[model samples]
Target: LSFSLPKCDTMERFAGRVTVYSVVGCPHCNSAKAFLKGLGLPYCEVDVEKDSTVRQKVKELTGRSTVPQIFFNKTHIGGNDDLQNLVSNNGFFSPQIKKKKKNKPSDLMIPSIPCFTDVKGERDNFAELILEFKSSGIIKSHGSFLKVHKLTFSGSELIEWLVDKKGFEKDQALNTGKELMQKKFFSDVSGKGDFQDGHTLYRLIEHDCLTALNSGKTAECSPVLAAELSEALRRLILKLYGEHLSPDGKTVDYKAMENSQTFQEYCELATQLQRLELKSMTREEKLAFFINVYNALVIHGHIKMGPPKNLWQRYKFFNGVSYLIGGEVFTLQDIENGVLRGNRKGVGQLTKPFSQGDQRLQVALPEAEPLIHFALNCGAKGCPAIRSYSAKTVDAQLKTAGEAFLEGDDGCHVNSCKNEIRLSQIFKWYKVDFGDTNEKLLQWVAEHMADSPKKKELKELLGKGNHKVVFLPYDWSSNSKD
Candidate 1:
C-alpha cells in the first residue's frame, strides 16, 4: 500500500506547569506580576535595573532591550498587550489544542542576510525565557529535552492544513511562517514583526534538495547549513511521509514504521520519558513531562476522535486522519482517556510529567494551567504561545509551556478593553471544575487579572456564591498556520 491510516494510535501525558518573568517598576511589568499572583501562581521576578549587567546580558541573549520583557516557556509571548490577548480569547479550554504560543523564529543561520525594513529588531533578549527554565530557588531542570516530531510535512502541506482546517489563507500561512522563520534566522530574541517579513528568505538558503523535489525556494542563510538542513528535510519527508489509495477502498495491509533509526530512538526515549512516578522528578521535570504528554496526547486524541480537525500537521496522516496508535484509530478521546487513567503505552502514566508538584525542585503545579495550555499546541487562537525550544525534561518544558500559555491569550489574564470580556466558556461549561463557589473562582481569577468590568462581572457572578459560571463557547480554530 502506498499509504493507509493506521487502525489506532495512542498519545500520553497532558497538561503542564508555567513560568514567567518581569521587571519591578514597569507598570506593565507590575501588572503582569500582580495578575499572575491573583491567579495564585508562583513566578520568579527579576528587576532589570537592580542588576545592570544582567539587563545588558538579557538584551544580548534575546536580541532586544525592553522592560517587563517576558517569555512563556519557549514561545516569546511578547509584552503586556500580547499577554492580554492570550487571556482574552477562550484560550485552550478543551480537548482541543490552544494556540497559546507560537512565534516567528528567524533562521539561525541567516544573520548574514539582511531583511526588509518592515521587520522590527527584537527589543529584549530572551533572558527571561531561558532563566525561567533554571532560575535559582525557582524550578530547576528536572526533565529531559526531547523532540517528538518526525520533521515531516513541508511549507505547502503546512499551509494547506492551516488554511483549510485552521482558518488561515495561503498568504496568512506564508506570512506567519516568514515571521517565525525569520526569528530563527537571526536567532533574534524578539519576533519577526520587528524583523522584516516583506521579503522572502526562500532564495537565501540552499535550494538544491528542495529544488530537486520541486519544493520551491527558501530564504538566504548559510549555504552549507541550508543544504545540509534541506537534505535532512528531504530525508525526513521520505522517512515520515505516508500515502494510500482507495479504489472503492479495498483494505490494504497497513505497514507500520519498521525499525527506523529515528523512530526507534524516539520510542526508546519515550519509554524512559514516561516513567517518573513523580518521586524522582524535580518540580520542573514534572511540569515538562506533563506538557510533553499533553502535547503528544492532544495529537493522538484528535486522531482517535474518529474525525480529524485538520488543524495541526496533516502530512503525518494517511487519510484526512488515518494513523494508528496502540492497535486502533487514535483520537482526542483516547488521548484524554490516558489522562488520570493509565494507558498501557508508556504514555498517560506520570513517570515523568508529574501532576504533583515537588517542593524540592522549586516547582509546584500552582493550578498549572499556563504551561500546559501553551506548550501543548491545540490548533486554537487562545492557547499559550509556542516556543522553539524542544523540551527535554517535563519540568522545564512544562514550565516553559505554562509561561507561554499565560503569556498568550489562553492565560487567565488578558485585556478586557480588547477581548470584549466573554469569560471563557470553560468556567460556565465546567464551573464545578473551577472552585467551590463563584466567589472562590473569582478569587482565583483575580490572581491573574488587574481590574475592570470583566473582573467586576466575574466578581458579581462569583460573589453570588454560585458555582455556575457562564458558559463561554470555545473557539476550535487551530492557532497554528495563522
Candidate 2:
C-alpha cells in the first residue's frame, strides 16, 4: 500500500492537527504525544509495534527505526529535538500558506498571430520555413528588420538558411525549396521565374503570422546568437583555467574560475549582451541567452568575491553585484525569476515579464520545461552541473543533463529494498513545473528513465504511485575548488 500527504489548500487545515508514530510504553513517545495534547492540538498516535507493516514503512520513510516520529501535513518535521526547535523558531505556529489567486480573461489574452486553417499546403510550407530557420544560424539581413517578426529573405539568403539553419549536410538545400515551391508555399516575381537577382525574395503568406510562428515552435532568434555566447564563455573558461565536473558531480574548481583575465572578458560580454537588441529575440533564443547569462554571471560572481562561506552569504552574492543588461541593472534573482521562470503572479516572485514578448514566460511555454532545473547551475554543491546551452539543441541537451544529474547521488537516490525514493529539493520546490503532483512526477521520471537501469523498478511502481518521495535536505556548501 502507498501513502502520501493529502493536498491541503490552507495552513489552517493542518494548524491544530498532527500525527505521531510511537510504541505503547515509551516515555519519550508518551511525552511527545502529551506535548501535542497540552497545546490543545488534535493528533493520531500509531503504535508501530502493533502493526509490523507500519513499523517497516515508518522505518523506510524516516530512515529511523525509532519513534515517536511526528508529522504535519506529511512534512516530516523530525523527532523530539526537531519538534522543540520548531516551537522555538515560530512559537509552535505553522507557517502561512499563500492562496493562489484566480486568473482572469484579460490575464490570459496574449498577443498572437492568426493560424492557418483549411490549407494543408500552406501549413506544410510554413513548417518548412520554420525548419529552415532552425537549421541555419545566420541572422536575417536588413538589420533590426527581422526583429519585427516577419520572414523576408533574399534568394541567396534562403540557400544559407537551409544549409546552415536546417543542418542540411546530405540533402541539397537549394533544390529542396524548388520541390516545396510546387506545394505553393513560396512565390517569385509575378508568380513565375527561375530564382535570380536582388529583387527575388521568399516570403510567408501573411495571414495571422504570429499564430503561424507560434505553431512551429521554432526559436526566432538565430542559433548563431546563442551559439556565439556559449562559445565565448566556453573559450574563457577553457583558456584561463579549465573547468571540470567533480566526481560527485556537485562541485566546481573555484580557484580556476577566479582567473583575472576570464573575469574581465566575461564582464565585457555581459555588458555587450545587455546592449544588444534583446527585445526582439525569439523564445528559444531568450531561453538560451538568459540561461547562459545567468550561469556566466554566477561564475563571475564567484571569481570576484571568492566562494561564499554560507547560505546567507551565497544569497547575498546575487544582491552584491548588479550587472547592466538591456539598459537596466539586474541581480541574479531578476534573471532567474523575471526571465527564465516567467515571474507568474501568485508564485511570490515579482510580477512582470522580464521583457515584452519573451517566449520563456508560462503563457508561451505553458508548462515550463522541468529539465531546465537540471540545466541551470547556481554555484552551490547541490546545484546541477554547468553546461553550455544553444537554441539549436537546448531541448535535447536538457534531457541529457537531467538524466546525468539523476544518475548522481546528489540528484536522486532510490532504495528498492527500503521502498523509498529520495530526490533533490529541486523536485520539492518546483513540483508544479514537473507535473503539479507526485504521481505525475513519478510517471515523468519513469518515462525519462526508459533507457536507464532503474527503468524496471520505476515501471513496477507505476500505478502504485504511492511510494514516498522525500526531498533530501539541500546542502548549501560552496561547490568550488578546495
Candidate 3:
C-alpha cells in the first residue's frame, strides 16, 4: 500500500528517535530545532549553555566544539547545514521493511507492515483505542513487538471489531487500521510463528511485550489467544473500576464511581456495544453482554439522574431510558424480560409472559438461567458485588457469584435455635425462576451450595420440613461506594 510521510524542510518525516545538544543564543541551533519540531519529530533537547559539564561531555564524545550537535536515534550527524544535506542527499528518514521468506503462510500474505507511531499523518481515534487495549492488557507482546495474545486477526477483522467497538463507519475503521500498520504502531509480523501461520498477525512493536507479560500478578493465562468480547470487557472492567467490594457488605461508592474516568470510558464502550449484532453473538457472549449492559446502565443511568431514593425509583430510571442494539432500541425491562428471561411477565411468575414492549427482541438465551439473579447488579445495597464475566467461563463464574451471594444473610439465613430460615427478597421476587415454594428454593440453594459445610447444615435443617420460612425486607438504599 502507498503511504505518505509528513514533509520536513527538505526531507520526509523521520521515524527514529532524535537527540539535540545545543547552546543558547545560537541561530543555527535554533534553526535546526525549529526544523525538527515542524516535522513532528520527537527529540530530546540538552542545553549545553547551562551545564558546562555537558558541553565538555559533548566535546569529548563528538570531538567537536559545535553548539548544535544533532543525533538521529543516537547516530551523530554534523551541524544544521550537514543535517540538511544528509536529509536531501541520503535517505536518512525512511527505513525499509525486511522481505519475507519464499514459502510464506497463506493467511499471512498481507505484506509485512511497520508500526503507526512513526507515521506523520493524522491518526484516527481507533489507534488510541488499540493503545487503550494494549494498556488494559488485552494486547500482549510477541517477540520484538506486542499483539492481541491468543488470537490472530486480519486487517479486515481488525477493522470490523474496531468499527463495532467504537461505532465508527466501516471505511473509517479500515483507514485507521491501514494507517496504524503503515505508521508502524501496529507491525505485520505475519510469518513469525507456526501458530501465526496463514493469519495476518499484526504486532504492536512500540510496547515492550516482555514487560507487559512480567507485570501481571493477577492475570490468568488463558490457553486461547484473543478473548471473546465478554472476556475483553471483563478484563477492562477489572483493570479500571475493579471489584471494590464494600466492607459493610452492602454499599458501593456510587459518587466516586460516577465521577471516575473508568466509568466514563465504560459509558462510551456501552454505547458502542448497543450497536453490535446481538443475534449473531454466542449464548455465552450474549449472557455476558447483557450483564455488562445491565451493570453499566445502572452506573451510567444513575450518573444521568443522581442516585435513587428507593428501588422503585431505580426501576423508573431503567424504564425511562432505552438502550440500543443492532439498530433497535430496548429498555431494561425488555432486556430482563424479552431478551434474558424469555419474555416472562415478572420474576415471580415465569409462565405469565409480558404482553407489552418490543416483541421484536429475540431471547438472547434459549432459556433464562435462574442464577442470573445473583449476577445482575441493580446498584442497590443488597445487590451482588460487580465482577468481570467471561463467556468462556461464565458458568463457573455465575456459580461462584451465586454461592457468594447465598452465603450472606441478604440471600439466606438459618436460625439453628428456632429451626427457622429467612431468605433474601430475591427468592421471593423470583420465586418462579428458582422454585414455586420456599422448599423448592431451599433445594435449589442446596444444589448450588454443595461441597460446602453450609450445605450439610442446610440439608439437615431443611430436611425436617417443620422449619419456618420468611422473606427479609428488601433494602432500597443506594449501593454507591462513595
Query: What would the TM-scores of all predictions be?
Result: 0.31, 0.48, 0.49
Which of the numbered candidates is closest to the native, going by highest TM-score? 3
Q: So what's the TM-score on candidate 1?
A: 0.31
Candidate closer to the true structure by TM-score (higher is better), 2 or 3:
3
How much lDDT does each candidate structure score? 0.34, 0.54, 0.55
Candidate 3 accuracy as TM-score = 0.49
Listed per model in order, the count of residue pairs whose N, CA or C atoms clash below 3 Å is 120, 9, 22
- The C-alpha stretches of model 2 lying farther than 4 A from their native spots are 1-227, 241-259, 345-367
User: Residue 321 deviation, candidate 2, in Å?
Assistant: 3.8
Tell me how far the alpha carbon of residue 201 in candidate 2 is from the true structure, in angstroms, after superposition.
43
lDDT tens digits by residue: candidate 1, 1-482: 11111111110121222233343223355566555555443444444433344544454445444445555333455555555555635433222113422322221210121211111112323223222222222211222267321112234543454466557777886665555344332121211133233321121111112211111222222122111222222222222211211111111111233234533333232222111124344434344434434344333323233223453443233122211211122233222222222221222223422223312122223332432333444434443332222223344434433333322333444333333323554454334434667555556555544334445655554445434333345665532111
